[model samples]
Target chain A: MKIKGKTWKFGSNVNTDDIIPARYLNTIDEKELAKHCMESLDINFSKNVKRGDIIVADENFGCGSSREHAPIAIKGCGVSAVVAKSFARIFLRNSINIGLPLIEIEQTDKIKNGDEIEIDFENGILTNLSNNQSFHFSKYPEFLQNIIKNGGLMKWTAKKYIK
Target chain B: MTITEKILANHCGQKEVVPGQFIEADVDLVLANDITGPIAIEEFEKIGAKKIFSPEKIVLVPDHFTPCKDIKSAELVKILRNFARKYGVRFYEIGKVGIEHALLPEEGLTLPGQLIIGADSHTCTYGAIGAFSTGVGSTDAAAAMISGKVWLKIPSTIRFIYYGKLNKYVGGKDLILWTIGKIGVDGALYKSMEFTGETIKTLPMDDRFTMCNMAIEAGAKNGIIEPDEITFSYFKNTLNNNIQNLKSDSDAKYEKTIEIDVSKIQPQVSAPHLPSNAKDVGEYKNVKIDQVVIGSCTNGRLSDLKKAAEILKGKKVNSQVRCIIIPATQKIYKQAVDEGLFDIFLESGCVIGPPTCGPCLGGHMGVLGKGETAISTTNRNFIGRMGDTKSFVYLANPEVAAASAIKGEICHPEEIK
Candidate 1:
């Protein structure tokens, strides 16, 4: 359970509305939503973001709106993971339910934009490839880890509740 | 235990629940709107669930882009309509539907001591009636639709007690803005805000709804007031005889307690970009405005309109400002018409819109352009919330919004005379 990618940085209180504006919320198509991912904050995000890239941000990322579109857009745009100082409650749950891995690290400022980083989900270790620095984040609880391991709540619930 | 804990524990079939403990609670009511309903239904189908756990328990409202702003939105609404019809789910059509939060309580769908979940964050609005209602995302809503249950981490309680009488221009909106300013946006993150005190008890049900509606602006799980006579009377004809009077226990523990003197408080305004960036209205007396919007689940009730009408009657809006008024629900819209508030608005040069969530989320009806400024009665003054990213929004009570429209700048209601 490890992920490696270049990082894109955002400031604190990055609201969901900026992640995906309300106008584009009419459709549930992940690809369509991905086209506008982070367009408000960075117009070139969807165009330049590569698969397995990472997004690192300051505190209270994904703050406004309960729209799951924010995480869906981020995940659909081929970002592997999002590491932030903290997340709004609903955003954290939505990301987990949708199988988008989110890590909370206190020293997010240490990771600069475009820095190559690797995250070890099992060991809670974050290695900055460019700088050779290491940081640690708390591991998820057992149940939450299982949900992530199962790839999302939908798959987890399907396996557990359905025959 | 606090009232929120009591409700969650009751639904979870537990003797007691503590903060930070994950619990799966039975949902008595579930809600989704047009914007989130299509996505939730798609996820619900992906789970391979044949039918909803309970058709009657689920409520769908298409208020966000109602009347179908575009072909895509129309198609989205069609998806919801077809699903609702096939599954026998309760659906409120355009004319019947308003803001989901306001419609639920007005229709008596939300009850005290009930655990309710919605796809929209403002769903916390129902906590005004003592219901343990909170917001979740589309996938969470989809899971709830299938299983009739959702997982929630028990949140600690933060109690706020208000005393003394409110000033003439001050109301629930001012109180909430003041609170949000005192506590930063994340001050109550993942915590239940239980409001109590003489001022709250005497406040009208509409004001209570206004107060609870903005709890999410402070990142609160829910904002609630114990059911009082005003709340009971609002539900008197609809509620059953066995209604519960849920309240916090005398020995209940709280993470924090805040006491506010209502009499000493002034009409507050949350400035641009953050609801927590609040200031006394006197501080921004001459901040010019380009638009004035008075509606949304927050501050769009009949009382809000009446206040605005009182300020706008026999007066016209300034030539430089665009004033838009939207009633929260159809019932409120009809009542405003019956009370001649619509005439006052039209004569005052305000554009009266149907019951919809127009322009509040920058969706439609009165979106601001670049470099514009608006004084809005709705909550959440986040950057680009009303329109362009460069546009500015100042949040205030309905009275201040109306007065600003007339003056084309931020002004207190008392200054209108």
Candidate 2:
């Protein structure tokens, strides 16, 4: 699948705290979490993030506790894909399992915010629509790609195992 | 390859593991606490996981809500109890057992070259004794409960070579806080941190566990130290000849290697907002503290309490600073009382609670009022995490926290000691 969107930039170690503050964790609702997406880092994150936008960050994106809410909040906030220099292990697995497309770019610092971008997972390339530049990332495993294609691990697992 | 990689390689049945290889590990064990076990049990039921993958492979600890604080939490513990009985799972509801991570390794549940998954983030604590341990989501944890093998991306290894001598009052907690400051939160993301060097040999088992316990805070998959004579001695008393020597190859390759000089280090604190936003306690002097709580999976060991009790023995806690002490488990709590540590705490006017998660998870008790500041040993001081969104929590070592509690202000341990 291909995705096209504007980009939002973040620095290194953007932890679960920055995504959804711990205070909001009492609830399991997705919309409630979206309200506080990036609340600690940018109080106005909900207002600034447009639907289907992408977030590019430095290394260690989504560090901290194993809060699935962090990725759920980001996806609920209309983030289409997250292209980071690297990702925390649990967050990476959880994000992909939840059907959020997260690509690990080699040098995300070079990309600027509000830059239009096109992500082609089929070819594993992210093209900078504004600058007409492009970057490559590792290909997602076929099993993981199938899970993402099915909208999440739960959905895929349910479809395959439950039924 | 480092100690972590060497262990992972053996567990995954690989001759060797380099970066970026997806390997499925043979999960030697799985653990869950009261807070997370109920959810996992629910999911496990959904998957119809009967008899578990192996009866001996799973351990259920009724921590977090041990005292059965409220009906809701009490009900959760009940569900875990029923699940454990039905599945033949080993359950440690209360008494002698304290902290699952501490007890598991002590009981020979953890060993070198094994993979363990716990439903708590501090599950990384097991790595200090040379096991590949990491936290998992309740559903993911439930899945592993049904199938003892978990998937993984054989993480790259990072080596930390420690050198020099630590000054008095400088303990394992301070070293971890200092390391976080140097590497930033994500420095070890998706990597296994292999801590080595002569300095590590000097630290006690409890201190070593403290260092590895915070590995999760740094986004590491796990943190490990090669088992040595110190490790053997600590386990020999409990393990009954199960203690084994596990070390990395001399030529083992590491993705990255870092050298930390210990002599220059001092007491460090993670300022409000982020664990990576660290500063020496000296820099935050005079920052008025409203609360001081020490004890968590992170620093709740006997050694930590002994140090804190020594500081509070002759002095009263600052009236303005409400200090609370909650041992990680009932066993530790009993140990404290038997040692007359409770006398020191009570005389110093500190509030001691039963062995429950309490304010650590911000579920109940110890909730800070708006705009108040707390110096706590518990991990994660995010906004509103401990009570009020406006309230701030500064994470510090037990020594620094004790000193700050006595002074009613943020003060480095060195200054008071």
Candidate 3:
């Protein structure tokens, strides 16, 4: 499967609290959370972000809290996928469990905000459509592939446990 | 195998396990709090599972935003209360609840050689007692609740051996802060931090908890101390006669080993934005603060209160500084009151509150506004962590928090004169 979107660039050590502030944690609704996504770091994020926009960030993206709201809000706000140099462990798991695609690539500095990019997940290739430069990331393992194919862990669990 | 490895291998029914191996392990306990619980419950419902795998093994606490910060928070806790009733799980109410890390261990729930998972990042605190515990996301909690199992990738170990005698002001909070300062926040990412040494052997139970609690700050999967006589003594009254503790084998492999000399270390204070920005408290002299908070899952224990009260006794909090002291759990609160620590806090113009995680997560009770600064014992001074994004936070131990309250500025306890 292929994903295409313009980029929203961020810096190193971008934490979950910066993704969605604790003040907005009162709700579990993705729509409500989406309204405040990245309000603390970039207050204009939610207001300006369009659906299917990709996030390109430096290392340690989504550090700190284990609150899944960070991923939920980003996904809810129509950020199609996140590509970072690295990710905090819990945030990575949450995004995967919720079926929000994440890519880890070296040299994220070359990517800039509003730079259109295209990803071929099945083939593990990402091309910055703006510059026509391509990068590669490790392919997802078989089990992860199954989870993504099932649309998330919730649906995967449902298919397994629900009669 | 290391103690962490032993626990993880035991849970997965593996005779031997190595780092980087993926295993489906059975969890002895699954935890979620008010913030994560409602979301996990939502996922659990979506799964349409037959029933909770083991209701008795599920623990829910509403400490993050307790006593209902607002309508939405109340609705969130209401969902937790209703779910607890439906499933017969152990739930802590606002009055009885404390920070999940302090509350669980105080109630004797955390034990050695158990595989525990929680939906809060600080869940790694349980590793202090020799349990293989780590934080997960909400949906992972839901998945564990349904099957009593979790998927895990074993992490290699990083051994931190601390020696030398500690100074009066230095304690677990400072040691952990120094470690984080030494290794950047992501230094130990996806690694287990195995803390051992002459200094750790003499460290108090509360300090051990404090050290392990911040492992996540260093990007560690967990921080653990080998269960020894001290660990056994901690659980002597709480656990039944069957006590089998695990330790790392003599030749246990570690990805890296670090040695910290405690004698030369000073009380540390993590500056704003990142825990890795830690330094000696003397580096931040005369840095005035608007508030002083001496509580949270981190340093809100009885001993922490005692340290704060020791410094605050016969002194008054600066008129400009609003000092908020919260005991982590009901039992700890009662103990502090019984020990007259509450009177000292109140006499010093400090406000003592219930067993809520208030103000720690910037949830409620005393949140900061724009451009305000605070010196707190709570962990994590991230941007907007305790209020407005423009606000600043400095992290220190209970002694520093109390002493800073008296001066309205960041200063050493010895400098209070």
Candidate 4:
């Protein structure tokens, strides 16, 4: 699987609160959460984020709070993928469980906001469409790959237990 | 194996488990708060789970957005109320509810050597009692609720030893803040933090809970202190059966070991936007504060309230400061009232709120306005954590928070005179 999108750059330690503040956590509706996604960093984020856009960040892209709303809001806001120098542990688990693709780039200095990039999920390659530079990340384990492909843990567990 | 490894292996029925191994582990307890409970319940239904795996093993505490911040939060809580009723899970209603992390151990629902999972990050707070508890997302929580098992990654262990005696005013909150300042926020990412040494050996259970609660602040999967006589004594009144003494083997492998000297340390206060941005309290004495919040999963226990009351026993809260104190549970609140701590708080111009996680996550009850600054005992001082984005939060222990409230600025406890 491959994804291509324009990048929205963020700095290190973009916490769960910044991704989606606690005030908006009253509802389980993904769209309601999406409407306020990343508003702390950019007030107009959800309004301006185009469909299939990607997010790139420095390090520890999702830190603070174990609320899965952070990833759900990101996904709901029309983000195709996220590339970061590193991901927080809980955030990584939540994103995979929610079927959101995350990539790790050692140094994100070269990736600029509004720069277009393409990701090859199977091959673990991220190509900067603007500069044509390619970087490689470690591929997910087979089990995790299947879980994400099956569209998160709920459906995956349902396939095995719901029958 | 380390303590964390031993607990995980035992739960998964594995003879041995190493770092980076994925195993399906059984949970002794599963926890969720109102905010995450609704989402987990929704996913639980989507997966068509008929009955809960173990009704007795599940815990629901509606503390986060509790006391009904608004109609939206009330609706969200109704979902948790319904789910708990349907499953017969242990649910703490509004009056009976405390912070989930504090309430569980207080009620002896979480014990040593158990593998517990929760949908809230602070669930790692249970590690103080030697349990292997960690936080997961809502979907994972829903799955665990159905099967009483979930996937776990055996993380490497980072051992921290604090040898020196703590200063009079310094406590677990100070020690943990100093440790986080020494090691950046992500230093322990995906690692288990094993706290040991003479300082921890005699530390009270409340302070131990305070330290373990902030393990996630340093990005640790869990923070634990091996169960000893102190731990056993805390449980002596609650359980008839003896808790086994659990500790890491001498030959256990650790990712790294750090030694901290609390004797030489002073009270610390973390600055805005990051818990790692810590500084000695004296540096910020000139920075006046608007409010002081003295409760949460981190430091809302009896000892914390007593300490806050001790400093504010006779002195009044500053005219410029609004001090809000909350006991973590109804039992604690009643104890405080019985002990006259409530009179001390009331006479000092402080208002006591119900046992809710109010204002900690900017939920409500004492939300800060623009340009306001507060010294809070609750964890997390991220931008806009306690209020508007322009508001600032300084993280400190309850004593420091109380003194700051009396002085209307960031002042050390000793400076109150």
Question: Cα RMSD (Å) per model?
Answer: 1.3, 3.4, 1.2, 1.2
What is the per-residue lDDT of model 2 for residues A1-163, given as tens digits with 9 covering 90 to 100? 7999999889887877678765565444578779989976678889889999999998888877676778878999999999998888788887876678889887686689889899998888999988888888888887667667887554554454443
Instruction: Write one digit per residue (lDDT tens) for candidate 3, span A1-163.
Output: 8989999999999999899988889999999999999998788999999999999999889999899999999999999999999899899889999988999999788788899999998789999999999999897777777777998887876777566
What is the C-alpha lDDT profile of model 2 across B210-269, one tens digit per residue? 899888877888888887778777766444343354677788888888999899887788
TM-score for each of the candidates? 0.98, 0.88, 0.98, 0.98
Which digits, one per residue and each the tens of the lDDT, describe model 4 over residues B28-60?
999999999899999998777897888999998
Could you report the DockQ of all the candidates, in the order they appear? Answer: 0.71, 0.32, 0.80, 0.77
Provide a comma-separated list of chain B TM-scores, one per candidate: 0.98, 0.95, 0.98, 0.98
Candidate 4 wrong stretches, greater than 4 Å:
B237-245
TM-score of predicted chain B, candidate 2: 0.95
* DockQ score of the complex predicted as candidate 2: 0.32
Residue lDDT tens for model 1, B157-236: 99999999899889999999999899888878889999999999999988888898889888889999988778779887
Q: Give the per-residue lDDT of model 3 (tens digit) for B1-417.
A: 888888898999889899988888999999999999999999998767758889999999998888888999999999999999999999998678888999999887888878899999999998888899999999999988887888788999999999999999899999999999999889888889999999999899999999999999999899999877788788875554444548888888888999999998999999998998899999996798999999999999999999999999999999999999999999999999999998999999999878787797788999999999999998899999999999999999999999999998999999885
Ten residues in sequence with the least summed lDDT for candidate 1 chain B: B236-245
Where in model 2 is the C-alpha error above 4 Å? A4-11, A23-57, A73-79, A106-118, A127-134, A141-163, B47-51, B65-79, B91-98, B106-108, B237-245
